[model samples]
Target: MAVVASLTDRKSVQPGIQSLVDLVSGGMEQVNQIILSKAGSNVELIPEIAKHLISSGGKRLRPMLTLACADMFGYQGDGHVTLAASVEFMHTATLLHDDVVDESDMRRGKLAARKLWGNQASVLVGDYLLGQAFKMMVDVGSLEALRILSEASAIIAEGEVMQLGAAKDIATTEAQYLKVIEAKTAALFAAAAEVGPVVAGESAEMKKAARSYGMELGLAFQLVDDALDYGGSSADLGKDVGDDFREGKITLPVVFAIQRGDDKDKAFWKRCLETDGIEDGDLDHAIELMSRYDAIADTVERARSYGDSALKALDRLPAGAHQTALAEAVAFCIARVS
Candidate 1:
């Protein structure tokens, strides 16, 4: 992954994004425990898989974004808690479904839900979580919240389907890839951030700004993640390098590498990516070709551009420490690949 640029002492309006992070640090435990407790039941496989995946640690960044956005809007209502958890459940549901779609065996350095509990179980449990998330949203009694999450979920599904079709298609373009990432990853982040303003009854403009910020941040984050999959440490990232390549998933780096490579290189990449499995040294060669073409730098540059855009979206929001932290986090997402 790219190294997050130095953010210490950086100027920011809302450092509350970071402060919110600190505030919500221990709060997620309660959410997770509650999920596990309530999920306990007749279906042993569901609990097993849910427990395994949930226990595998995550930063709970989605919920943090939701809470921070609410707080930034001066919301003091306790309903933010349920909204936060709902966002997390939505996130976790996507993870379960994503792993199944990707046929991924590992997540957070542990067995993925599909691997541990079987694909059928993983898919069903993912659905269950989505239902639970909606139920919580309904409990919050906000039509805006329902609209945000529902629209996001639809976008996410569309993105996933688009990506699935895009994979291994040598004709895939950079613009198309960006669209896929925007739908698959950024939509959820945008929803997570936007829903907070919705819950807090912030002005339409503020909600739009928050949504745009998160959408840009999510794009930056996923672009960097793709770059890292092509050239990153499994130990550092908690996921294997070349995962995108291994799965025949055509990410930005691969698209760039193909576009930049010579005819022979292009042909070779085509064969490797289309085949069921890549041969020894194909990954290394791909990496070398990507390097020669500066694919990583290309991805980084794009991520940085989006990071700047995300910070720009913050301009319309209320000034506070949390906003600064959110901006810093955006910078960190892009820099993390360095």
Candidate 2:
């Protein structure tokens, strides 16, 4: 409820993302059509499970990034739409898989597909969506685009595996955590943005710039989400506050708190995280420790640093409305916590 309320308030003050959404509305409509068309199947369960998550209230930001990046380069082809759908499918598949892996009950403010349907159904449907995604990519007929996305898929899986190994490990270093997110999250963002330039036949420099922008933006996005898990309300997060804490996730705030804490604080983290012995008031204590060490603030500052890198990445592109929207998009990602 608080996340919803926060979203309502944010809508009045945040026009940056809205501007980008509006700018890409026509293309998004096409992407939506493609998504719906591709999500259909002869088996009723496939569409049922796929539509459950697809119709959920995610911003579809990755696909929008694809559309905007291609438009920024003055691409006048239908390839962007198909590629955008591919990006969305890839994202959706990951979400389904991630929820299962995380044992999460909620996603986009609804019961996770794994909770409603069995994990097997969720995973199989996710695979189906991925299959459709690759088909769409091949339809685009750009070997380079297909290659980038396919590589990203493998990297994302590796990231998830890395997180599995690192979960509840209080000793996880900042570097290791960063590597996990870079692979798990930023890779897709990078690939999504890069393919736009690839489809448009843009130069290597422009493609690299777009990829850099997406990578940094994604880092900022996930960092903000990490900070919000402790400080943000359920409405602001779309999931319960402290979900990461409950899951014993080794997020940036947790890492910072551990690093800055005294021996007693380390003991506390070990009890709650390493052993998964969380109890009432533990989340509050965790938040208090994070606040004492300025962990949340420091995390937001780090996100701001990444946001700056994202903006700088845009410098390589010629000035245009799409470019402006993309820059604003980066700012918006960091602004969620602010």
Q: List where candidate 1 sits over 4 angstroms from the true fold.
A: 1-20, 26-30
**Which candidate achieves the best lDDT against the true structure?**
2
* Backbone clashes under 3 angstroms, per model: 22, 4
Span of ten consecutive residues with least summed lDDT in model 1: 1-10
lDDT of each: 0.81, 0.90
Q: What value of lDDT does candidate 1 attain over all alpha carbons? A: 0.81
Model 2 segments more than 4 A misplaced:
1-15
Number of the predicted model whose TM-score against the real structure is largest: 2
Task: Tell me the TM-score of each prediction against the true structure.
Answer: 0.92, 0.95
